[model samples]
Target: MSDSTPGRPPALPVTFRPAHTRAVLLTAGAALFVVITLIALLLDHLSPGERVSFVFTAALLAGVLFLLARPKVVADEAGVTVVNIVSRRRLEWAEILQVNLRPGDPWVFLDLSDGTSLPALGIQPGIARQRAVSDARALRALAEDRSTPGDAAPPG
Candidate 1:
């Protein structure tokens, strides 16, 4: 949490993440990995090679869960960094046209000056809708304050 007011940009170097999602994914991944490995170790009926394979399978599942918890958004003095499941992008404030999180949207989106919109998965509404809305508003204010020209009205 930040000291900034509601709908206002927080201090620089703020990070936004799906806190509940990350916690659940990481916890479940660790638990599954531990339980599966223990079962593999305790099963005497299985051959050594079969136990090793079971452990490997558990590791693979845990890896996938780790990937599911990877999305995050980091905002700093230089710009905003968007980290999704498989891709990361850095954007200067001036390059972003608007930040949006419409109703029914899964996550926030950045409308860029290049005319393409980028999904910001870090601020997802799943399990934390209010937090996501606040985060989107703060990001939007930052984009409007830093990127929009002083003479122009900010976009909605």
Candidate 2:
């Protein structure tokens, strides 16, 4: 079935991220960072070494929080881009052979024609599941369309 309505654009390259999870992670991180930094700056009795340590800890916490919230998958007309903390990958639409978003799966897996299972971070199973499923349908449709012999999904 077509997901596109007459006035709406076909959904492809759907971005799936657990919004509440990410928001909580970021908010907590920011609050912790700010609190730690302010305490470090305001504590008049802190030794030079302790102040330096607090600064380091605040920076470290912020960095870790960013890393934790850094994974996402984008499936666009061109292909899919899986961006995880510290690494990223791109696969063309024609390269995807299957889209797997089974029960209990953390995210959808793209079974590539090359025999590798690539994770689609955006089409996750938890948090906003309805949206995730809809995105998955869009992904599968796009992948299938591209796999066909003629009139493949737009890829550029």
Candidate 3:
């Protein structure tokens, strides 16, 4: 029961991302990756294998850093996408039964109809309290509008 029918008002996607703090981390990671690669290439003391390993290590670290800094949540008319440090999940609006952001929690959690809870790392509490709360409210509103009444179970 998506809320995107032609007659119904379209539900635009609302993306919740960490504030500008990640810019610093992204810049640092990208610089390190480039610098280490250059260093590995310029060092004549290292063998070809060593240079390759060095470059690989730098690339790996950069990839991880980029991932860590790119976590976000994209909620649209169809569903929501949660991108965390190591994994990504997509859930329909109906699948979301509740959105919880307790005082002790670091990030907001989405209570799914399947009895599982999914963490939305983008809406972190401590740093972006206001934005996170706003995001939660928007997500809850969208979920409620999309979940058609009388539907006994979540979308399969």
Candidate 4:
């Protein structure tokens, strides 16, 4: 009953952790929050105007937490969902023109039909090389399975 191609297994969904930068930022933000709270408390004794400063600090902390907690990417049989640090984009399997697994790249960049690229979190070279290879292969497989026979272009 499945519409999937014969002889090719479906791609399993994979969720990648947030990029290392995100973790570092989150940790720094938490530390900053603690330090700011302590400073605010100390200032409380010296000046009544410290309340306004505390409010600004709280807002900044909240913004940082929100950014750090955002999802990076979600991949599945159908396609990949890339949640950039500030935005989200969903690409269907057939729409993916290429996947780059080059060294030094922060993440897997998926080339689209329009010549633009979207990042997949799993392809981060910062992770183990084996993991990057596996993720790249998986993405290649998905692209091949979904593409027409003649459209099996090499990944960039």
Candidate 5:
């Protein structure tokens, strides 16, 4: 079925990490690290050194990275963009071969003509169901249209 509506712009497909989940995880990690550090500090007889402090600092830094490093799925008229913490990949509408909705999968994978798969990194099926489904439908429609008889193949 045609995915676009008469006047409405095609929805911007975005898979956002839930703020609450991020906050909870970060908070828990920070709390645990702090408690452990405090315990280490209190046991003076054990002679904790700079190494213990360094370990706690590293744990805190890791927690911060985890909190901030979430992915996003963005779609527009031109194509779809899968944005991760360190990189962003843009796939044009014509390049998308198919969109599959596998509910139990960790993330969505796009099947390309060259037998390679581009992952929708930001989309977590269990966490972002509705948005993922909407984007999948739109991508599927675009892929179908592009694969018609007269259309050109997408670039590698």
Candidate 6:
């Protein structure tokens, strides 16, 4: 019932993520947390409340970095799930009319059947252009392969 069969262009349940970006963001967050915590502990001249504030600020920044590293795209038999910076959306294969990433675009965008475009930030070209291109192509292929002929909308 899936595309795991031999000779298929792609298998089901594929995930695309900005691996390098995520790694850098997460590592930076961890380092920031550690350094800030250490500074808070070492700076005895600062008041207790000020030290607490510094650690709290560090935690807030690290949390933001963690959120920044959370974007990803997942394609499966059911459809595709796009996780952006602060939003998540699920779409059936037929709902995605086209996958687009233009020359100056920062990330992939999905043209929906409803005449709306959704940004797929998980496949960004920030630090990895080739990977983003490949991911966009694969997503396009999957959308083409899985969409029902009559149900698919024409690309505008």
TM-scores for all candidates: the values are 0.92, 0.80, 0.76, 0.68, 0.57, 0.89
The alpha-carbon deviation from the true structure for residue 73 of candidate 4, after best TM-score superposition, in angstroms, is 1.8
Over 1-156, each residue of candidate 2 has an lDDT whose tens digit, in order, gives: 126554343576467565666777799889989999999999999998999999899989988997878877776878878787678899888788888888788888889878989776656657677667666766677777666766555577
Better of 1 and 3 by TM-score: 1
* Least well predicted 10-residue stretch by lDDT in candidate 6: 1-10
The candidate scoring highest on lDDT is: 1
Q: Residues 69-105, candidate 4, lDDT per residue (tens digit)?
A: 5746566867778876678888887788887878677
lDDT tens readout by residue for model 1, 34-117 = 999999999999999999999999999999999999999888877899999999999999989989999999999999999999
Candidate 5: residue 43 Cα off by (Å): 5.0
Select the stronger candidate by lDDT from 3 and 4.
Answer: 3
Candidate that beats the other on TM-score, 2 or 5, i.e. the better one: 2
Ranking, TM-score, top scorer first: 1, 6, 2, 3, 4, 5
Name the candidate, 3 or 6, with the larger lDDT value: 6
Error of 4 at 88 (Å): 0.5
| Whole-model lDDT, model 2 | 0.76
Candidate 1 global CA lDDT score: 0.90
For model 6, residues 1-156, the per-residue Cα lDDT tens digits are 123333344687888899999999999999999999999999879999999999999999999999999999999999999999999999999899999999999899999999999999999999998888888888888898888687668789
In angstroms, give how far residue 139 of model 1 lies from its true place. Answer: 0.8
In candidate 3, stretches whose alpha carbon ends up further than 4 angstroms from where it belongs are 1-11, 148-156
Q: Where does the lowest 10-residue lDDT sum fall in candidate 2?
A: 1-10
User: What residue runs in model 1 are displaced by over 4 Å at the alpha carbon?
Assistant: 150-156
Q: Please give the lDDT score at residue 24 for candidate 4.
A: 70
TM-score of 3: 0.76
In model 2, residue pairs whose N, Cα or C atoms come closer than 3 Å (at least 3 residues apart or on different chains), thus clashing, are 13-75, 13-76
